[model samples]
Target: MGNTINRRSFLGLAGVGGAIFASGLSGWATAETKPGVANDDFFFVQLSDSHWGFEGPPNPDARGTLQKAVAAVNGLESQPDFIMFTGDLTHTTDDPAERRKRLSEFKKIVADLKVKNTHFMPGEHDAALDYGKAFQEFFGETHYTFDHKGVHFIVLDNVSDPAGSIGDAQLAWLAADLAEQPADARIVVFTHRPLFDLYPQWDWATRDGAKAVALLMPHAHVTVFYGHIHQENHHMTGHIAHHSAKSLIFPLPAPGSQPKRTPLPWDSAYPYRGLGFREVEAQRQETQYKIVELPVRKV
Candidate 1:
């Protein structure tokens, strides 16, 4: 489904402790949208790398930044059909109890979102903790498939291995899942790391992503959304368009822009710099779908 609504405004988080919208959403056109209207046009927000429980100079109040993101979503003029957090829900820890605590806190914060249908995927940070045991307990089924509004959505777990590989089981599952869908179905994939070799030197590429990409190549309309590098990036694999969303906590340098892969320092003067979500305006047609990436706004 596609919408013509001009929800193109940016949200600036005032400070670290309290999340306030520096700029509000304007230029919205009212529609006859009801509580549960089955329309052909709808949109969703992609929020990633909130990094709750993170404490450091890069972002002191990681928890509050996530809260601000929630507030920004709630403050939308019209609620999105759904919201999906691409991963790194929390900063990782080796301690079992501490991992649970961080996930628990993240769940509590996201519970405030007005959007009822929210999806989550795991990044290396969460999946590396206990080899995804702890993450699965908190968020069920790291990799799965679902259908919504004539589109086939697949969530892949590519971070369970430190080297970033989606194992054989998941690959077989992906093959089976794709086999079920029609050849022309509009497919959307969500994951944590870049499915392509964007920058292998920094652990940015998914080791087995080529296999998955090959599986998806048969599909005519495919779009992949993921986050791990903590920046907005776009790439093309055959006909698939892969987009990476910005982090809620802090932004990282562009692919190979910096000598080292480190979180860019936050500027106190320009707060919320490079921290926000990706707004996707998707439109669905009979046999195909289209996606347009709106500007990455600070929220």
Candidate 2:
């Protein structure tokens, strides 16, 4: 079983307050996705755990590393319709000022991008302590739905409640939200923590993910994307496919492979520093799906 590492304790040990990354650079990951002629037939980028306010051996220049991730998204030949930053935007911090500063800087970075729509969700690092109240103040609605092309986009907040579960209130909201959609509509779900049992010991999987999955089971086509694990992990459960993206902060060991897992330390020797994201192109008018992990380095 692959394990997802927890970043909360790591942040405390490193004492990332105020400014976590004054300078740093990590690795790279990117996917090649060309858009079709249809304006609506475009792919999107998934960015997670940039941890703008982080300074550790994993990334001596975390700031630079996160910048690279944003640059890659902006440099795409054909821009994505929008960008979704699943969460862990800032390093875990009890200091409200640091949280506010981190998100403020994050906004500046994304504002520089050319994409039209960019959304966010909170990770445990962000919500475990504060319930992501600061995140909501910066990004607006944590859970909402929208239609893109023919796909129904649902952004869920798995970090809003204690125990890292979707909670009864949000669960009810999700049920009602899906009820409003037509039967045949395709759906795409975005979140910070995985909705499946990727690794229970590490708190990587959501407590009530199965209930949420059940809600989308009737749909003909569905895809779920998430972050927080800091690596590329994918699984197909029934009709839904779940995928995780890499962290701009640092790399982590594969799930369950080690007695303890944490983000891999920065290997300056490696090109582009070891940071990356995911590129997903929802196949139009078909059940087939294509998703490629985009590394900061050349494939």
Where does candidate 2 stray beyond 4 Å? 1-39, 272-274, 290-299
Candidate 2 overall Cα lDDT vs. reference?
A: 0.68
TM per candidate comes to 0.85, 0.82
lDDT values, one for every candidate = 0.74, 0.68
Query: Which one is best on TM-score?
Result: 1
Compared with the true structure, what per-residue lDDT tens digits does model 2 show for residues 178-202? Answer: 8886665567789888999899887
lDDT of 1 at 32: 24
Q: How close is candidate 2 to the true structure, as a TM-score?
A: 0.82
Which ten-residue region of model 2 has the weakest summed lDDT?
Answer: 21-30
lDDT of 1 by residue, 64-177 (tens): 788877876677677778988899998888888998999999998899988879998888888785778888998898888876655568999998887689988999999999
Worst 10 residues of 1 by lDDT: 20-29
